[model samples]
Target: MVANQNSVVVVMIPLPLQGHLNQLLHLSRIISAHNVPVHFVCTTAHGRQVRLRLQGWNPNAVSTIFFHDLPIPPFACPPPNPNSTNKFPSHLQPLCEAATHLRDPVTSLLRKLSPTTKRLVIIHDSLMSTVVQDFISLPNAESYTFHSVSAFSTALYTSKKVGEQIRELIESKGVTEYDLSFDGCFTSDFKEFMSVQHEYAKLSSGRIYNTCRVIERPILELLETDARSRNKLLWALGPFNPLELKRKDDGPIQRCLNWLDKQASNSVIFVSFGTTTSFSLEQITEIAIGLEKSDQKFVWVVREADKGDVFNGNIIHVELPKGFEERVKDQGFVLREWAPQLDILVHPAVCGFMSHCGWNSCVESMSMGVPIAAWPMHSDQPNNAFLVTNILKIGILVKDWCRREEVVMSAAVENAVRTLMGTNEGEEMRERAVSLGQEIRKYVLGNGVTQTEVGSFIAHITR
Candidate 1:
């Protein structure tokens, strides 16, 4: 597990959010499986969080991967506002600001590793490019930008003449302009932050996406045009988080899995939003009512919104409608703890997902052949939802992006659940999803396009 002085090593730097951290950690496992030494660098608290919440693989046992938990100055970690008109999780801006302080520690780590290793290869989340900006000065060090979002979403930001190009792309696929909207996704400050990250990516040695040609051939082709036109490097070696085993412990996640055993095939809908989302109490009540009225079996995973620091030892509380759990005891399961999403999605009883369309969730659902009711919150989610519902036709939009500010009433929620779970149209989408999932799984195996891409990346880095 220990690297020798002459070994080539990879250092991973991820944005401190759950989705970002999860992707990079999964990437670390992939790279390490190939006999490469990987140093995963992050804030101390976030490093602990990533390890504790990691599913598939045990971080402590991964000797080839090292955790460099650097300290960052404290900053405000405000809870997200679901009622805010702005769809973005702008509340996490303070964490973004604090991440800048990692510049010094990161730079020092690079310098220390430079003389000892044959080469220091840095794979960083595109947004964290600023923290590793100084890597250019080291002759033996090269950095690649890892995009956690899908290639489809990345193209919207990277393509030149963005509006015209995207219009043509969408229209070519038979999508209506009104089908996709980003009316209030990002505020000016957040836009500036993203612009800086996209610009910083230009300075990296290559671009790496958690995508494969099977899922986003056209989008990947578009990115290649840009990367090749500029003579920049690019690779699509993904469908990360590949494992699917359920946890063995008798925890809430396992209990949820056990409950799925008794349900009929394709009879349950699994509803969960990613970690960054926080709904207002009223909205939470509406969701409870909606699920109850839908008259379908369901498993809803609910958690308290993050308050700046999830590690601050404060008791987390998320209130539901009074007696809601008791009322739905026979018909539904309300899981208040962390649920193993892949395990749940792969279950025979679970047929559909009501999700925020975060790219991670998008990939997982499609990979498991589970259809989605897309209710995107912000960021690349709206665009990702558009991809699922409009282009691929593997999912349904639960709510349009323009209506994000309004509280989606229980009636609307009930309708979406019914449409995705109880209708023949939903069955057709599920059939398509199953076919697509089979293709994805195929490509990630021997001699497949995704595995080939992974091989190419390893050969490039280790050669």
Candidate 2:
């Protein structure tokens, strides 16, 4: 898929996180597949990890795609100490600081490109909206912010009426289970980040979301009609998951598959909280006890406390409850490092998922016909959990609020796990998930909603 001399050149700036990078990379692949040249920008560390993760990929197949690495800038706060018990507060400040520093390097790279031959378009993560200003300042270049979360979450953030109501609710009382919408779920740090992001988004020409209009039609309509967002051009172009691509299984993946082969259909639950979510020691103990008491077969991916550290290429040493592994040895498998998540989801034995409700995990679970046990941790996850459990009615909520310190009791966990794995409600949810999964695959693969939107987006940017 080589681009001609006069073809559009897309510059993608992804926030340095596993989920954000994955979404942007998939979007870049879609654009490159359309014969558009893409320059994927990231820090040196992230770029190296991206290259290693996609090592088996044949670059010659996608001749129009390229990666540009920028040196990581120093942050005011030192990196989290490995031995620290408290979780890293937030990754936004450091990421924003780095993006601020990259303005010069990124601008220099753009200036060096042949302007006449390359019609430029910048698509960047919403979190890194600060960097897009520099790129869009270039002559003949258009800019669009790419939101990796759901349109519902975005609408709540952008709507003035909704924002006011949420603020009032928060001021009166903290987030509660009854108030499960985005306004009710945001953490203080996340609220500040969204405030900055929403302001920065005004600088972009438009916005693009990795979602399908069919899945989020009401919210999309609301956003379009809202005073704040009505004038802004928006497009929903996903359910985009590259994991849908078929590949040969490696040693670890094969082992997971082999284990699944022995289990009964719809008997196993797949548990993970994406790459960056980490639980406190007490929380992990409750989860362990809950899983053991539920008497269900499970596969759990356990990462360390340092949420910001990714792709270290070393197995994480997570400390579980005393003799916990031995106690659940016959009933569960604990993956202390990364596992092939997509592989596990598609297996017949994995009937349900225990997830943090990140958009990627939600989309993946729904796409695979696996119902979810929505355990939202932070950021947009609480909103996503509401979408899955309340709006879609395809999963059950594990917890109602976003407080990480409030340890969820083992009894609550046990009940949620049982509801997802064995109860009649769980069966109904599984049926709905399977039906929705078919619709999602149809929309993303065929000449469906996502395909049409992606086409329109490319045409708009190119023009």
Candidate 3:
């Protein structure tokens, strides 16, 4: 296609992580809809994997989209001491390396595409701000970093996760990094994230968040009302949601979805922790046991902790209480190592969600109008749990003492699930979630006033 309008080149620093990938993917569609001849940038190998998947997906070339290939990363040996728990507590560093290396190559590639390729939107995740800062120019060729978290959740994250780190980095960088016990200081990740974010807000042409302003009205207004930050921050982009799907194995998945469809309306509880977050062998067992004790119909989807099938394991017997599956199997207690989540949540039978309350999952659950049992695991999840339980009034929080990150025992899990699955409480939660879901749909549809204003963000930057 010839350049009928000013061209926009969207650069996505693709992580092996799922939520980040899904956010960038949603941006690709949005950029395309805006009439920009958008090109997606991904790692050489991941790019190949995407191509292979898409070939299987669009055998008929139904969708008109293209991905730009960048240099392949060299294979590196495994970390000297690999503790899955502490492993890559800073995955952001490598992504920073990726953006630094990929930027020039991407700019050169985009310019070659057309004379009207006036700007570049780099959908860099919050953790990878170092990569974004290196980008030389903004107004002519701009970059927009997408916070995969809501601004409020981001606020919470900054308060706890990010700020704690900044304090550590300031107070005792050596102590915080080296001493395992000293490293246990819990503050706010979202605060330090905002430090990087405010910096990014200044340098970039515009700020893009993967949240609808409606849900986080105060946070959105706070960002907008600031004399320091005005149109620079943009929201109301989309549902920006994701699902697990495989084209080659679509048949079996479709069958599972079909079975879910046949079940009672709002009867199933969905449980997933997403791809990047891992549950230890111990954690998985407790979750299984908890769900069993809850005595509710469930469709639990646990991503493999390591490389292999979990079904052959004691997922039912060892993971859950003995004979639990046998008892509930008749009630349609479907268990899977993975699931087509977006499909499952959107399914009519899905009454509630039992989630790690990762930001994307939080938004998706809310978007689908499915009330949630917020079992927040690591990172910004606890803050999102707070948002869901307190701010939204759309769902209930399954908290454990003062310990938000504690592995929820079977009793709490049972009670929480029972609450969501039971009569009066469950009905009320479903009603609230549905009402909020409709409000969020406006951002995804670009029909809301706040969202439509986002399109002018580029213009605001130039002026």
TM-score of each: 0.95, 0.87, 0.76
- Overlapping backbone residue pairs in candidate 2 total 0
Best by lDDT: 1
Q: Per-residue alpha-carbon lDDT of model 2 for 20-78, expressed as tens digits?
A: 88778778888888878889998877776555444224444788889898886655533
Instruction: Give lDDT for model 3.
Output: 0.58
Residue pairs of candidate 2 with colliding backbone atoms: none
TM-score of 2: 0.87
RMSD of each: 2.1, 4.4, 7.6
Cα lDDT for residue 73, model 3? 53
- The true-versus-predicted C-alpha distance at residue 237 of model 3, in Å, is 1.2
Model 1, residue 36: C-alpha shift (Å): 0.6
Regions more than 4 Å wrong, model 2: 1-4, 51-61, 76-92, 114-118, 161-177, 180-194, 227-230, 305-316, 402-404
Name model 3 segments beyond 4 Å from true: 1-7, 48-64, 75-100, 110-116, 132-134, 137-139, 156-202, 227-231, 242-249, 305-327, 332-337, 401-405, 442-446, 449-451, 457-463
The CA lDDT at 442 in model 1 is: 81
